[model samples]
Target: MRDDIVTIEPDEGLRTWGWVSYLLHLVVAVAAVLPGAQVSIALLVVALVIDLVKKGDAANTWQASHFSWRIRSVVWAGVLYLLTSWLWLLFIIPGWIAWGLISIWFLYRIVKGMMRMNAGLSVETA
Candidate 1:
């Protein structure tokens, strides 16, 4: 049998951008769960912008799933936080607990996505 090997090259630039976005997300997520250690919202916005802008570039590639994953995580967390805002009016403790849970969930998603990306796998599969 004739042997013909085909090798596909990975996109380094796309991976680099993915790492940058993931790091930004990790920072924001970690800070969110910490008391009195709030980080600037601008960092989250910047990460979102990077994901939105570069998402197109990753289309039809494995990295595309990561972009979508991060975007969805942020959107869902925002919605959850908004819905739970009324708890603050009722009682400060309830509000704190709701937000704290949401923050932990956000942190979990970020960490999971980063792990999948590092493994050169699609977040969708996880």
Candidate 2:
């Protein structure tokens, strides 16, 4: 009988950047969900840019999935927000509910990604 052990090494630098991006995303997401606690959209933009720029560096690595995950999360949330913008123009209560739900979803994604990254696991893109 033979016994073997396998070890996986993670890129610390990429993980550091991932942590920074996730923290930024978390702040924006939390602010979005809070009433009258709006934060600058620039923080999200900065996080997105960091993901976009560092995505290539993560290619072929487990960390790549995290970058993709964050990027897709932002894109989907932005699209959903834009699509539901009409609710705000037509009615107030519905708009509040819709946006609130979207913000929560965004927050969930960021937190999930952060957890996975911390665990040194790849995020599920699909």
Candidate 3:
């Protein structure tokens, strides 16, 4: 039996930034779900740029992972959107299917990442 325990020291700055990142993701999700995809996508891009800029300054693995997760989500969603948009003219149904899948993926990443953040666990990229 292993009796070792792990403890994470709290950092107010990282926690605050983490919450800000998560809230931005939430805004993107809600806006994307409604009729504000354009605005949400622009916001998402801005959020991603901030994540990239600040990731190097993160104090711990947990904080870095959150930024990485957010960046991955934004890039994946953007690529998927662009691909679907380009192909929509040829196959409308497939485009819709791709969009739906992307939305689910986006939501899943944000929810899971936030939950892990709250639990003091690092986000798993894999």
Top candidate on TM-score is 1
Tell me the lDDT of model 2 at 23. Answer: 98
lDDT of 2: 0.88
What are the per-residue Cα lDDT tens digits for candidate 2 across 14-78? 88998999999999999999899989999999999999999988877778788999999999999
Q: How many backbone clashes does every candidate have? A: 0, 0, 0
* TM-scores for the candidates: 0.91, 0.90, 0.78
Higher-ranked by TM-score: 1 or 2: 1
- Error at 66, model 1, angstroms: 0.1
lDDT by residue (16-119, candidate 3, tens digit) is: 87788788887888666654454545666667777887787664555677888898888888888987896689988888777877887898889899888888
Model 1 lDDT per residue over 1-126, tens place:
112312233489988988999999999999999998989999999999999999988877778889999999999999999999999999999999999999999999999999998987888777
lDDT of each: 0.89, 0.88, 0.75
- Which candidate wins on lDDT? 1
Candidate 3 global lDDT:
0.75
What value does the lDDT take at residue 49 in candidate 2? 100
Better of 1 and 2 by lDDT: 1
